[model samples]
Target: MKTVEQLLQAKGHKVISIAPEKSVFDAMQSMAEYNTGALLVMRDDELVGILTERDFSRKSYLLNKPVKDIQVKEIMTRHVAYVGLNDTNENCMALITELRIRHLPVIDKDKVIGILSIGDLVKDVISEHQFVIEQLERYIYDTPEI
Candidate 1:
């Protein structure tokens, strides 16, 4: 039930981005440096696309060229799927499931704020379930001879 705004608050909005003109090799280096699976492709201040490990693996094969010779904009997924701060974690999960996407960029006030991965949503769901389980256990234990 948590909103993307709350989730970002908890996780911190540290989005790693790459310029569209950057080489895929550079993008890969950044991803490795940050230990991230994806990067937002930015054109100046505008978000143009998203580059992910999947894109690199799938498209690079089609190009049959070295990553150093490939541009991020050439292989990156141009049709980006994004979310908003008001969106709920559940809703984002649903969208990700339907779209078969692993990462979603969160936008607020016409600006990109953060990104959420499938791992993030799954972790939140597990945490929420744990909280509910703990609360139910507490209620049951505190109540005497129901």
Candidate 2:
């Protein structure tokens, strides 16, 4: 089981964040620039909430509120689901599945370290499975055939 620490190391721990007071347009632009689906809504280094594409589509666009007119705090998801650096990839996958969320902030000792997306979890699982399959094949070929 690979820990989030390893995952972050492989994926690079670059957390794209935006201030809670920032305009929705700003958050969206940051998301675009980062090529991410969500952004950590921070307030003076504290993880206040998460602003996601769903929040934008559902809250702002649907409400017909212009991005410049609204703030991230208004549309950001307040109840965030988070993970720790020591957490296993399986645990992260389970949490994301059960919570039905795309992104989770990775924390270590109350400090925000990185963020994990559903895409990241899926990629990790696929890589792990591929490695296991290759190992099994090597072992089978190295042994006598039945």
Candidate 3:
């Protein structure tokens, strides 16, 4: 039941972005530098698209042209799936699973706040489950027989 805001607070709200007009090569470099599989494609504070490794592999790699010749906008996924601050981790998990996407931009009040990866949601789910299991174990041990 953790909210997106809580997850962002735990993971840090650092959203790495790239300009849509930038070359795919630049996007790849930025992705490497950030050690992330995706980057938010922004146009002056506006979320226009998302550039991911899958996009590069599927769209850019198949082209005859070089990566530098291709713009991020040309290959980025334009129809973005996003989550709001109030959204739950389970909701994000379902959305990503249904859409088969790895990243989701976090928005609040019409402004982009942070981004979530599939890995992030998975980690959060695991942590929540661990907490529940631990609580259950403590309860079972502490209970006294009637």
Candidate ranking (TM-score, best to worst): 1, 3, 2
- Superposing all C-alpha atoms, what RMSD in Å does each candidate have to the true structure? 0.9, 1.3, 1.1
Backbone clashes (count) for model 1: 0
- Residue 72 local lDDT, model 2: 90
Better of 2 and 3 by lDDT: 3
Q: Candidate 1: which stretches are off by over 4 Å? A: none
Return the TM-score for each candidate structure. Answer: 0.97, 0.94, 0.95
Report lDDT (Cα) of residue 100, candidate 3. Answer: 96
lDDT by residue for model 3 over 1-146, one digit each (tens)? 89999999999999999999999999999999999999999999899999999999998877789999999999999999999999999999999999999999999988999999999999998999999999999999999989
Which should have the higher lDDT, number 1 or number 2? 1
List per-prediction Cα lDDT, in the order shown.
Answer: 0.94, 0.91, 0.94
> In candidate 2, how many Å is residue 41 off?
0.3
Estimate the overall C-alpha local distance difference test score of candidate 3. Answer: 0.94
Worst 10 residues of 2 by lDDT: 58-67
